[model samples]
Target: MSAVPEPAAVKTAVITGADSGIGRAAAVRLAEAGMDVGITWHTDEAGAERTAREVRERGRLAAVARMDLTRLPEAADTVDALADELGDRVDVLVNNAGTGSAVPFLDLGLDDVRRVLDVNLVGPFLCAQRAARRMIARGEGGRIVNVTSVHEHQPRVGAAPYCAAKGGLGLLTQAMALELAEHGITVNAVAPGEIATPMTGQEDTDVRTVSRPGVPLGRPGDAREAAAVIAFLAGPDASYVTGASWSVDGGMMLMGPMAGSHLTGDDWRRP
Candidate 1:
């Protein structure tokens, strides 16, 4: 058998919220994997520029754009601008920008709930639509990966809006996959557990507890680890994989309410 050569084509990917956390990791990894990257940051230009620098070090073209996802009117235009700047329509789209609310569900104002939904759900819908249309016009297969979270399936006490939005995103991924498959486009999602990142907080007690005896892996997931999954789904290897919600949660989802109930039992070690 002959070894396959590295891909020579110069692919382009547009990643939202590329300034930090999983988004930052993904941008760098994709650039290293030989893809020109278009990145968007909501506020931190410095961080975005740093990510671009890293991409350049990987010897790939990098374009940075500022996007406030709340301004839903600008979503498609934002994608078009990146496609123009990158000199190719997006071959991959990673919808990783998301915000969460810690307030109790009852105390949450309508505006706050709406804000979360707009960024997490509506923003990705607009961006994916724009990117898919361009890719379909080109008559080439493309990939769209939504960065969901474990909360997409499991409910959290104070994260009603975040959970709801991600849950909606899961279904949206399926719907988009069905609709876009005919156009040679694939839509999928990566649902990560408590990953160590700025978004998760370096000192977050939640992440620490997440890796306790409760979790099967007994540790919180790393941002780079999550990025690896996104990279695979974005690359050619995932051609047959679409409309799938791949959970990167260290088996957290498998731990039901009875996971720890047997911890006190002497027979708990039998497994």
Candidate 2:
């Protein structure tokens, strides 16, 4: 009989855009799962500090850095900075930093499209490269979870850049999974829909009291709900899962056709 190999221990993680929302929740969840954390914020330093406090309260070490993904290849250095501060090896990385635009597809300026693509797609690509290099050098397996969105699979009227970037990222996840498998690195994506978070302008609001008519669950998802899936992918339990896009959308994806069939006017066209 062959003996089973022990699952690799995840000692440290680097999470970007963790100053609020799903990123914040994922950082805390990972901390609770017994991993030191490196948190990155774009503009909300105070919010990142609060997230760090939560991680520390969980008795895990926490480090913070400012990561502006729009800065491109240079901003990705934040990943290495965080990894270095947290003991030189990143056992997990959550590329949660992103931006979106709501302009109509024809109205999007080149700069607007570029900014969205750079922040949402290019940034995660570079960060993953940096972390994967470290993981390879360390000779230990690693996990990477990219926080995409329902836009990855379906399009909204005013989200040209967002949909483009997320769709690209979803495909990137599959490519990374195939190539990284040889290095014992697993890559996956978590796509959330209508989650109550700062990104969706729902900060500090109780999700249970809000309603999402398009979602079959009848409510927007909690950031913690998405974070739970992220934490699972980062931990040993999901060791065998990779290249999969887990939708934490409360069945929103299933209602797309239903929603289209029920629209009554052109109001849906004006983001």
Kindly list the per-residue Cα lDDT of model 1 for residues 204-235, writing each as its tens digit: 23454543465576767777888999999998
Clashing pairs in 1: none
- Which regions in candidate 1 have their CA more than 4 angstroms from the true location? 1-10, 203-211, 256-271
Estimate, for each residue in 105-172, the C-alpha lDDT of model 2 and write its tens digit. 88889999999999999999999999999987777789999999988998888888999999999999
- Clashes counted in candidate 1 amount to 0
Task: Assess each prediction's global lDDT (C-alpha) against the native.
Answer: 0.84, 0.89
